[model samples]
Target: MFKRNIFICLFLALVISCGGDGKEMISLHPMQEKMAYADHETIMLELNEVSGLNHHMPKSLLIIHQYLNNETTSGFITNDLSVLTTDKVQISTINDSSILILEPSNNRLIQYDIEINSYEIISDQGRGPGDLYFAEELSTFNDKAFVGMQGFQLSIFDCSMDLCVYEKTINTDFNNYSIDATEDQIYVLGISPFGNPQDSDPLNSDHNLFHILNYQGDVLNSFHPAYDDRSPLVRNRLSSGGMIKTYSNKSLILIAFDFFPYLYEYEAGGDLTNIFQIDNFVQPIYESKESLHSGFSAGLIYGNKTVIDLTTRVDDEWLFLRLYERRNIGFDHVNVTFTGDEWYTYLAYNVERRELYKLGDDIKTTPGDSRVLHVLDQGIMVNNDGKLKYITR
Candidate 1:
């Protein structure tokens, strides 16, 4: 599968480099320095024995711990475990009392009602209407659920009531990581389906970046932000995966790159409004092409690269980013353990105030700290020794 994907990407690269439509993507310059938002308490969430996933609603908190195992536990933050599933699952909140758990392996969704403490399988597994397969990303906006599946497909379901019925499915061209929506428009963030011929270097080839679509999944506009050309092995490796969130009553969009240090803001009309560089945050160290193909496990890949684990929004004023920087540790040993040199940092930005602040002063990653799984209005949710904990201010 890896070789197949690489071949496909190479073929696409060649075709795009040769005959891609020369529609120039807009690039915006970034501010070199980031303004401090304010003094914030130190926040750190480290990985533990258990892996936890969570979704935060306005009035309720859902936690899933010991994931991808027979003993998986799903419940509210203030309550005991009420549900269990053997298959791996991703979750999204439909409301304060109900949530959807997607088992991508099985291509189905499980609806858990917090009020009655009951679980029900809501969607089936298939390519037909209302069915899902290999779904990776799920989110709810205005009572509608958007599910991003493999094969560059997006399925939309109306979950306004207790059950979610299939509303529509969108076949997208690019590979997307996250999805957001307002009342009338949907925003998808991912690598551009089309490559730029103007990019002189294949390593730094321009990615179309973000796309705006209507309820019908018709793309209205697309934006390509300015990024330093880097990745040596893959064309989109340096700028592919990122998170997008809607703010200011869904009139604006905020984007944070996984491998890059800049944050981008776009208007409703798809204009590159502002670009921000957080203070003390530097560019990521790219692994050499040979090192990347050296048979390292996912852990080693993460341990050797800088990555943004997650991004969240607080109302419309605050934007929070969780990032980690790991040491190279040398690629000599095929199977090596990660040392304690990794650093975890969180940055908070006040979009309204145009200020940014680092949440913690300590740069060292703590031992046995719970991994950050989700960000809520109350605090960060983590998994600690097979249990769930919320770190609040």
Candidate 2:
């Protein structure tokens, strides 16, 4: 009887080991924290008063930045019969007239021009544009037109004429880092999620370090610390990710983690400092009964000012908040500055009038499912049926 029991136990252990190796299990660590918001709250803000007020641009200019089935592709509308696949994950606008799209699947970057009422594919460069940035302060080497691709290569394009002049391509392995450049230097934020083995382990370093690269793709300095390492919280299980911004000759790096849904601010070249936490300003409306996994949805920085929109969910309720940072005094935590209380604040462009509004609330006229394409100018583009609509305050 003992021999039979031992054989059965050994067989069970072998089966369990095999199951654990092949299957991925997501476990949420439960905490005794209370829910932030118990009931619904209404917050209203005017749209035009914010600094970067988002007005409906031309429909043709709205490009669908999509990662379908892990494949990167671009199209005008959902059913417009226009679909082009490239090296996946390259989606950015070149200028007001052209959209620089990247397909990482095919390792190609294509420029699409919008003239009159039609879309035309202009150039097909077999490379990946890592990330796209606009504004003068975020451009290193004084290149009016620029695109950063994978393999740490940045292509400076001349957009004055119809044909783009590929001035140069600099190669480096920043580890799939996202680029945000200033006149003097380019800031690349490394995104090493848990799923990617090649990326650095956050728990080991306790901070996500960003490389400050020069115009020639040379590493100048490293900035931005991981939230997990800086925070006083114990054994925190937060995933760190953020958007890089350069303004007033300073780099504004916004980092957020899931363990504690708070936004940490840091100045680019300065000692990695924590300027402000989002929770200090905007109170969380809903706290997850399980575990809250929060992350910054989108962000934009212009001049000495910065704006970030964050998304968090607790239980079945979804929460969104817009935080603003002005010239010198870090982030403004005044609740009255924006809206009082609201169920959801999708994005905030203008803060003077507290322009906080929800996206996809209008379904009757805008007939389509609301899908968040990509965040730009603190505004989100939702696919309304076959058309793209911008949701902003």
Off by over 4 Å in 2: 1-93, 103-108, 117-156, 191-203, 206-208, 227-241, 249-260, 270-345, 349-370, 373-393
Tell me the whole-model lDDT of each prediction, alpha carbons only. Answer: 0.54, 0.35
- Assess candidate 1 and give its TM-score to the true structure: 0.63
- Residue range 194-312, candidate 1, lDDT tens digits: 33574245444444667888887788988764343333233345454567878747467788777655566777777766666554443443322212223211111333445676676
List residue ranges in candidate 1 displaced over 4 A: 1-77, 84-91, 101-108, 192-207, 225-233, 248-250, 288-305, 327-338, 341-344, 357-370, 377-381, 384-393
Which stretch of 10 consecutive residues in model 1 shows the poorest summed lDDT?
Answer: 1-10
Model 2, range 190-273, lDDT digits (tens) per residue?
A: 433442567544345344346777777787776544433311222222222234444423334444333333334456563544
TM-score of model number 2? 0.46
Q: List the residue pairs that clash in candidate 1.
A: 37-356, 46-369, 46-370, 46-371
**Can you give the TM-score per candidate against the true fold?**
0.63, 0.46
